[model samples]
Target: MVRRRLFSVNDHFYQGKPRYFIAECSNYSCFCVHVEGVQNTSCRSYLLFFVSKQRRLFKFIQPRTQLVATQCGVVKRIFFSTGELSGDLQGSILIRALTREALSRNVVVKVRRYISRVVVKSQKTFQLYGLGGSLMKQEGLELLQDTSKISSIGLIEAVPHLWASWSMIQNAIERVIEDPPDIAILIDYVGPNLQLASKLRKIFPGLPIVYYIAPQEWVWGYANQKVPFLLRYVESIGEICDKVYSIFPAEHAYYQRHQIASEYVGHPLFSSDWKKGNETNQKRARESLQLALDAVVIALVPASREQEIRYILPIMAQAAKHIQDQLVDEDVVFIVPCSRDDFRAKIQQQLTRSGVSQFRIYDKTSSSIVIAAANLCIMKSGTVNLEAVAMQVPQLVLYRLSNWSAWLGRNVLGLQIPFIASPNCVEMRLVVPELVQENATAENVSKAALNLLRTKHEQQRMLTDYERIAKVLHCPEGTSRAAKSMFELMQTD
Candidate 1:
């Protein structure tokens, strides 16, 4: 009987030349010998092996030996599930953090489509792929699908895209099964992610799954009537995920109460240098927009989602008209920060149709600049609220769901929450005025915006609240900490 052994050549370059390795196998032992500066005639290399048995040496040559690096190190495929523009941004940041942390741990990260082969000192390679947007792709995520454009908020709003979403989920599951990931990271966009997690848990029982920026069931779970649903949600997450990284202190506590393996990693917004801006930066931003430094700029952020743009932009436009009518003497300019380039035409039409003349539309790239330059913001109740807070811009949060969806949520689902805006939720108080559902009328929103703009005391009070909230959410290198935790989880036996 004869024994056979195979060895992989490490794909590396030595002094600007490719290196190869040959394996020598005997009847009882096998070892690899490195050959430097070997020029391969073709992709395949032949290795001659000698076996010693009973003090006799036998010579053999292996044919068609492929110069591949499979046995060089461990290859960890990580799948990331994220949705919406905010999730895309967060996912990008987290991806960067993960890459950095991996490098620190002597692991190399390679994007399948962009990177063919990477030669590094690390023996481990992390291949990242999954559902995200262009921003995540830019951060080197081999995207399975793009969910940014299709994300919807309310139940009624999501109904139209249900079939497409289901199809996407099915396709994702099929792909994931075909090329299984060693770890899965689920960001926000709770609906499909929860479903995906449940399916993955059933399919791959031992797979390490993580939930980052988990659902806000804790906030809605405050209602006694909603506790059952919240419990189910918590249990589903707890059962599916190996770890849950919470961005908020309250979120961490809530998960812990439910006995979910969780850690508070703080908000990812604070991980970057764009957390807050000073007056000088504000002035510079205004100047960049060709606006006078003293001009009172009111930013209208209707959100990035298509349903949100449809339901909220018109009302925000109408509110801008009302605000313009009230601030006739002051140099107040209304600017709509388009979160997506495709949404610009819709926003323009809505603003124009609303008869607002002194308004400008900025592309997604200029959103932060517009926020920094703004005196106040009239926006939807979402992650942008926290962004406005970071910029120290007093804002009036407005959200309008479909009438049917709102009714169902209030009457059937019994959804109750103290605050809709993240800043308010973080502070556990009314940091910014929230006009939600029926209350988010043009007149009400404009009135609130005018009050914030005219009343210095109110603006100062909100600014103070924002400072406190920022302090609470500010954890240095928060995303990095989360990546470190996730990497450690990936290393568990």
Candidate 2:
């Protein structure tokens, strides 16, 4: 006897309406039947059952497994947590990479806002949502909270935002528990990210947590007393994260020594998105800024944080004035690329007060173009240092903090490192001149900038070092590699 059974195999939305697919199974065969007019609730069950107890005979149904998986909403949901402007930039790139990788795997991805009921409509395979800023949002990251403006560097600088930061952490924990992700990616922004990792591990013990651009705890063990602190930090990371992707080779080795699951993916700055600067780019950048081809351009990149601006921009302005005095015979123009829109008025006021002439401030311009057009970049010691290296632009890196914060970091935290600039750190030597803390004065900055401008040998030596740094960070399509690794991790489970 040929018995028949109807199985509601697939139920999903088409356009704005519900669509269902029914699989009719007999003792001899099984076939799918499209039922657009049927309501999802009208189906008795979603499961497929065999009345003949001859499931091995249903070989044709094996090919439909992929379709069933897709229709059943079996997607890898990735949660990304990042903060600060730099984090936002990195997160945005990673998000795009993730989307592209998913599409290549024949998956559909969707982004859903953390707080809003509305979901971002798309035809991708992964569901991405987390904490980020406008840039990440633009790349289809459903931001839980916008954290681009809530950044601080030092212990003292973070005091005012402590309460708000704590509240954000609590909210993040609550949301994750509500709809736990298949995988969680935590970018830089150490404190909050580390906290989130620890909490998520306890709440969802099996959830895979990956850390990208991890904190530089390995570089902080200058004193013997700090070794324990460094060990503790690395241990916490190992305990919390299932995988850690390091941008620096030395950092990757450090994590490996401590028995952490880590891989060196190189820096995202060296990814395909940013091409190495050449004469063509330099000429175009100069033209875009309306500068003469023969004119010497000095680019100034201050810190992205407000506190950093207060401690650093004024000194940078004064340094620009000093350079102008020394280069009276040369047609020199200073370009200050504002990192944030809100910082423009303050930067303008500081430059005006310093009596610096023949200078222009660009608010909405790409820093890459500014660096490419520059003969020398006087900037803070951060991600921008790596950018300058990528562009082969000679730079003088400087950084400053409030007196109390500086003292606390040096004395209380016992924070000591050989190099602050990213290029020097990667090279394990001072490839670029760094004027930090009290040494970061107008005279020191101007003197260093002028030396690089006047001495071709020194500039060429720096360029050579940049080439070496590039080799160290030479993983092609690094962000895509990172995304592929993430997908592999998801498949493992």
Cα shift from native, residue 65, model 2 (Å): 14
Candidate 2, overall lDDT? 0.74
Q: Model 2, range 307-376, lDDT digits (tens) per residue? A: 9789999999999889899989999888988778899889988888988888888863367788888988
Measured by TM-score, how close is model 1 to the native structure?
A: 0.81
Model 2 stretches with alpha carbons more than 4 Å out: 1-67, 70-73, 108-122, 221-232, 276-280
The alpha-carbon deviation from the true structure for residue 229 of candidate 2, after best TM-score superposition, in angstroms, is 2.3
Regions more than 4 Å wrong, model 1: 1-73, 108-124, 221-225, 228-232, 273-280
> Each prediction's Cα lDDT score?
0.74, 0.74
**Clashes in each model (backbone N, CA, C under 3 Å)?**
0, 6
How displaced is residue 18 in candidate 2, in Å?
A: 16
Q: Estimate, for each residue in 1-493, the C-alpha lDDT of model 1 and write its tens digit.
A: 0111122122222223232222222342222233444456333343433335453535433443333333323455689998998998789879888887776764322111122332323333567899999878987899989998878876688898888788888999988876667678999988889988899888777678899989887775443335535325787887788889998888888899889888887887766623432223688889888988888789999978888887898899999999888878888888878888888888888889998988899887677788888988888888888878777888889888889988877777666767888987887777789998889999999888888887999999988988888888888888888888776655521
